[model samples]
Target: MKFPAPLVRLWHRLGSPRWFFETTAPWLPWLLGLGVALLGAGAFWGLALAPADYLQGNSFRIIYVHVPSAILAQSCYMLMGSCGVVLLVWRMKLADMVLEAAAPIGASFTALALATGAVWGKPTWGTWWAWDARVTSMLILLFLYLGIMGLRQALQRPEAAGRACAILAIVGLVNIPIIKYSVDWWLTLHQPSTFKLTEKPAMPPSMWIPLLLSVLGFYALFIWSVLQSTRVVVLERERRTQWVQNFVAAEGSKA
Candidate 1:
């Protein structure tokens, strides 16, 4: 199957470490600024302006943070899984760099989700922890992230470590669906998805609007974080190369 010329060019460029670094460098500050602005707006709106939930009251406002974190957690893993496939099949260096860069960020997001979920749960469920399917699966997701990082560091050879971590990432892709469907598949304290693309949101625009902003903000920040991390990995791995040496010299001169 033939892909479009533009898409093919994009795919190849994305695989190039030098191209990736140079292309993304100018966008980092913009992305960071936009993410911060949107997140701040959404947080203030949700915490102070949005109406309280009749049942959960002010506590439900935490969804602004919790939902975005959980969504990014899964989304980041999916990205790693895609990179894993690319690394295994095409042996793209950028993919390996991405795997190294994104694992810790993904894990941090997962931890934040779990922590916020616990805080939200205390008032709603009257417990800080539970063995509920969705919660348990999310915990497993965190471990999966940790396991991938550990495996990568454990191997003596960089090539072997990248291959092993890629395989593990591919294997762990199965858990994403389980996490998504757990609330529906079994009885759990967790509620069904609050927003759906096909269906209208159960909450009013005043409520969902801030959530939308927060989700977009989280995504922007996630991209910025991953790109920044990947750039560091690229520099570290390519330090001996002329391009990297020149790049470092240029940066040092600016400093």
Candidate 2:
């Protein structure tokens, strides 16, 4: 069957905030529900059912949280950079909406990565913190997330906030590669990267599969949260506009 080209064009055309909001609202409930369900299931399987590592013992279970959080932290920044690219190219409010929504979340993930890593480190590496290149690069990532958020706050106007934050986000993205390679580049104290999804692992899928599900669950939650935050931001930014006032009044009238 041949798909209609115009339909595809129309679909892409409607990816803006207004179209996205209207179209995606119905799916939000399911997205959030599935995210929660998967998170619980994955957590149980990874933390309780999975066998302890031969060397690390039960201590390795920390990977259930630490690995997912660390992966999300880096992935979130990459996603943020993609949003910045959209903002630069499309000049659309929705793109800015994504970045604005993502700032706090990305920061929280970075914090989680650092905190969970510290917890895992105490047993495995014998220290809570260190100045190794990998550790320092992750620290820099935390600060970069903070920097983007700060830029957003420093500017009151939406346009100013978006542009400033976008710049910071772009600059900060340069650190992602450095973070990924720091262990190899500088012989850092941090453990070498072992979870390359493309590569075969020494461990069997029975263990890593559940962990991967947990990562996907965290990602879904992050996406849902960012969309929610972006919606709120759009409303606040457009509050004084006629559409927003009418929209609010209509909702309030319904209530």
Candidate 3:
């Protein structure tokens, strides 16, 4: 089937490693700067400026980090799954690179979410671990990420590795909804979200504002990390190409 003109153009543009690398290179520093600034500001405001919870007290501050990390972790998996679909259906090289680059980052964020959750739990729930629906699903998500990374490493051929990882990523998409609604669907120790798009947040503006900043900052950081890693992947994968060789030589000359 024929795609719309704009989508077709976008697909081709994204598939070209050289174009992607060059296009994103100039934006990297700006992206990093914005990410750092937002994150720093959010940290300060959330940890210091936002009033403590009447019930949870100072412990509520952990949400500034935990919520953002959890949100980003789920988003990263969705991103990888989307790339997996593109790689499988369209056989796009850039899609494969994106999927590969995203796995470890997703894993890191998932791990952070779990770690922070455990830390928060120690105070709130009086335990470090629980097999609650949300926590269990999130743990499964982390394992899925590790599985994809491991599958790619185990495969010898690039195409084989990409296909294997893509399949796993696609299958793992099921867990996203589970993670999101686990609290509603099952009796769990984890609390429901304080902020919802369709409704006013349970939190006051001062608290939710910093949480919003944290979310945006985490997303920016995720984008920056993915772009940086994708650039390196592109270079290594395309090292045999004349463009990459010339690019390397140009850099070497500068050094």
Please tell me which predicted candidate would have the highest TM-score against the true structure. Answer: 1
Q: Which ten residues in a row have the lowest lDDT in candidate 3?
A: 192-201
Give the Cα lDDT of each candidate: 0.88, 0.77, 0.87
Q: Each model's TM-score, in the order given? A: 0.91, 0.85, 0.90
Of the candidates numbered 1 and 3, which has the greater TM-score value? 1
In order, what is each prediction's RMSD in angstroms? 3.8, 4.1, 3.7
Separate clash counts for every candidate: 0, 0, 0
In model 1, the number of clashes is: 0
lDDT of 3 by residue, 100-152 (tens): 89889999999999999899877766678866566777887888889999999
Which candidate tops lDDT?
1
Model 3 misplacement above 4 A:
1-4, 175-201
RMSD of 1: 3.8
| Cα lDDT tens digits for candidate 1, 1-255 | 999999999998987799998999899999999999999999999999999987678998999999999999989999999999999999998999999999999999999999998888888777788655657678889999999999988997878888899999998897667655764466434444432112333899999999999999999999999999999999998898899999989989999
Evaluation by lDDT, superior candidate among 1 and 2: 1
Q: What is the lDDT of residue 170 in candidate 3?
A: 86
TM-score for candidate 2, residues paired by index = 0.85
Report the C-alpha lDDT of model 2 over 173-243, residue by residue, as the tens digit. Answer: 87678665764566534444442222324877868888888888888888788878878877887687777
TM-score result, candidate 1? 0.91
